[model samples]
Target chain A: MSVSRFIAAAILATALILPHADAGEVAFSERRSGSTFMAPETQAMQSNDTANPGMLGVLDGATLWGKTIGAAEKSCASCHNDASTSMSGVAARYPAFDDTLKRPVDLEQRVNLCRVDHQRAPPLAYESRELLALTALIGRQSRGLPIAGGTDPRLTPFVDKGRATFMRRQGQLNLACTNCHDDNWYKRLAGSAITQAHPTGYPLYRLEWQGLGSLQRRLRNCMVGMRAQPYDADAPEMVELELYLMSRARGMPIETPAVRP
Target chain B: MLAVAAMLGLSRAALADALRPYAIVDDAIPLSLTGADGDPARGRAVVLLRQNTCLLCHSGPFPEQRFQGDLAPNLQGTGSRWSGGQLRLRMVDASRLNPATIMPSYYRIDGLQRVAEPLRGRPILSAEQIEDVVAYLATLRDQPGKHE
Candidate 1:
């Protein structure tokens, strides 16, 4: 048998017999991570926790975690206790599959589920300040840890969908997500550098924005830049794309509330 | 873990006057032929204006813009690299050279997807805007960092 044909046969057999999650760690481009593309001062802003504005959201989150709310009169602390223990490593493994939902959910959605189902509260609005605070606070607990999740067989379908969204061309520009972040890493436009589009520092602050934002916000901004209509908040496509990004950033450390220019 | 300490002032500098205002020419003129001489000043406007957002994705010789993008080639020496003819082709349709290029064609509008409802079937940059930008870019003939 020819090598190419044998390889194809092996791949088919693997697809039939095994879940796609077992296909190994996501293949990330090693050329340059997102941080590398940042201006040096932006990097500095991210490293200094005291100076980072994202920490303000973290503080707000800490307060929210302790305050009892909802019809059940419960706080995040009521069940999780100390976030340092309960929430640690949780953020790193998000965009995980939920058996009940039968699909993947990013950390923000998971927070809403806890509010609605566990705490009997209303779901927080997407891109809300409160949501960002909680997410940043939880994410902070996982600082320095590599991104995880998307390993289960249940996530394979969503992961596949996410990959398609990332690869597919969209917008009036007809550009894919990979066009700048993947293909043009180290290249300069106007004056800013492009880096590999890793989602390590989400719920992060941006100097350009002068405020905190969710990954979805950034994605929407990219769409606007491309002159494309943005998807609605909590769109499944957003979650799916988030999953693909998390999987691609498997080994990279988390930098929630990271600062950027 | 190579942390760079960007001590250079990271102030948000807007080159508000980097580009001067100019009027658009005609669209029917042949793209291959340069019509009324493109006003470099107005061309700069098409590139640096916020409504256009070209500065958001490209860096150039605007000293006033403290923060410029680095997503594609810096426009420091674009004039020396490609001729006005070449620049026109790129402006009209960059995808013809590299289908995968992220750079949007300034003029072509056919077969685009996901465009905002308000901008359907309209090109991002008008033909006059393209010529103007090309003219301004062509003036960047010197290499970066050296005074002409």
Candidate 2:
């Protein structure tokens, strides 16, 4: 049978057996009571209040920022001096399309471009610990700045695609990103409540992960739960999704390396 | 290789009789109450296998089943704290009790997926499987001198 047919059959079988099945009979000893999900405001508050200990990425980025690389005999500081000054408010304007490349460029992509063109250094691996740290460091410079995506006309289509992806339902639970984040942000799902998909503060530490990760990594995790294959780290779909998320959180302050549950 | 074989043998002995084929067919198996007598040996096997996947989020006394997750509560002395019914709810469908639980319902109704058939509604575990898991959890008593 086709994959679609199999999925359909599986879903139907599940529906038929569930109603007759006993309700609230099975239990575990360590079941957590009360709300299972986090509320958006609470989630944000927690992220803001907590300090991340494993923010080694920012330190790494700081070290690399001033180091000269390749035969070009230059460093990131060669073009932009003192990130605290020149690069401040830069992260909020990202996931923007580069007119020269005709593609959207997040801060990470832009950094890699500089590495190749100016520094003559190899691009860092996507999702690598070092890359995440560099991105976090650069993003941290723009902390408290309002998100400024979608300023470029070339980014319009991607923003639309991302919005559609956010609202589209998938997975065995038949849930869309908007169902929990938009419609039920205040409601609980299992043990935690839903939080808004704010991408302003990222490359943050999560209690669940016990380490730092980028916004894209978190997005991939959600897709896994949705039972849909996630796009590759640098995939266009992911870029578009980032575009949509940044747009949604357009005015939120950037909070790189924020802590989350 | 010898150590591996020994560990597998120990696990098999712990798991063997509790999860027989008949247990799979029967939907109304008895669950062990927290204060009731329990066989920890049987519980050990149920947790180790995918039948419970409890170890997915928790760290237990078992040294061989190490995993890196803290999503669920630790199961070391769970039997002493909660009643059997509460445990059943957590395993069968955590969403009914707590909406934010990431734990999949081992047994619950179907609606999360779009479908046309009847059997593929929710989960692979039946009611009996849930009871068996509960029985295993009842054995997690704290040993007098052992603390971890």
Candidate 3:
């Protein structure tokens, strides 16, 4: 082949290899779940249900799903019986659009909404153990399914708002989420490795926290690390950010109750 | 007259606890916070320390360290790249220059929100520590690291 023809072929190959490097998103083929960056021990802990501490929350959730509570005298089993069948693939499409509130609500918020609106029960507090357990339980049903968030046309504006939050600089550090997760993922920050901020493992167990926590808890921790003020527990901004992150991991597998460093 | 003197003394005490005033001239704070030059040895200690969070995002000329970071520019040759006054400004608040830097404002206390309760109302480093870090950084006149 002619030298110029060879050069042309090389250029085409490079384009095919790095399709999204310049499009401001990680390429489809290059995306990795957060678990890929964990140490072998942590990975093992997440894979084994008996060994995983997050499974404790799932166990608690199983009990809560069946226990009768509130004035309506009903359990979650009353409406959504047999979660393994009813809740399957439900979490994969969450932080979904809510028509009544005209915005997005995460799985935790959805659970609380059900308690308040249907069961006439008071809303669960954010980060409460019961909420984590229920979310972990429901989220477990979607384990291994691909995420399908941010696909609704109604969520376009909220997703854009979330993306803006991800890109905006704040705190004394003046760093945006992109500066770590988007620009320098897989790099080391002191003793810790920075992973892509995927929302695949909500209500996952973090070694530092020594308990299962929601994605909002982790996001709040990062903001505090940046020396920035965090949003309120039930802030719409938090839901929007969760929605956007789930959108980013659209085709990635869910690992609810995942263990992490 | 006695009451007036007591009020004046109280205000003076409050001023002492606040940040030292420094002027910015075209991207630099040309005066020392403690009104004296800092010790380079002490400055080196501050840079290497983990609580100061410098090495968490910056790789420098220290050959003995195993886990330096790559989030920011290499610290080698920073002495030649910038003046001491410029370094002071960067250490105090890098955002004044880049507006989007991940480097924390080591000596700034205002305009920050939701700082953890334990660290509220205080700079990340003391005035003397900032000066010491500037002094150590000013001595870093070596060539860029191979990792760069």
In lDDT terms, which candidate is top? Answer: 3
All candidates' lDDT scores? 0.75, 0.63, 0.84
Quality class of the docking in candidate 3, CAPRI style: acceptable
Tens-place lDDT digits, model 3, residues A87-156: 9988999998889999899999899999998888998999999999999999999999999999998999
Q: What is each candidate's DockQ, to 2 decimals?
A: 0.24, 0.07, 0.24
TM-score of chain B of each: 0.72, 0.60, 0.84
For residue A194, model 3's alpha carbon misses the true position, in angstroms, by 0.9
- In model 1 chain B, the worst 10-residue window by lDDT is B8-17
Residue pairs in steric clash, candidate 3? A229-B113, B43-B132
lDDT tens digits, residue span A85-183, model 2 = 987888888887887988787777888888898888888887777677777888888877887877677788889998887877655444567755664
lDDT of 1 by residue, A1-261 (tens): 333453465456647754421233324545345777777887888889888889999999999988888999999999999998999999898888888988898899999999999889999998788999999999999999988857777888888898887777777777777766665555555555655678898999977888999888888888887778788876898899889888888878898878877
Which candidate gets the maximum TM-score versus the true structure?
3
Q: What is the clash tally of candidate 1?
A: 20
Q: On lDDT, who's better, 1 or 2? A: 1
TM-score of each candidate structure, all chains considered together: 0.75, 0.56, 0.82
Score residue B12 of candidate 1 by CA lDDT: 10
What TM-score does model 1 achieve against the real structure? 0.75
Sorted on TM-score, best first, the list reads: 3, 1, 2
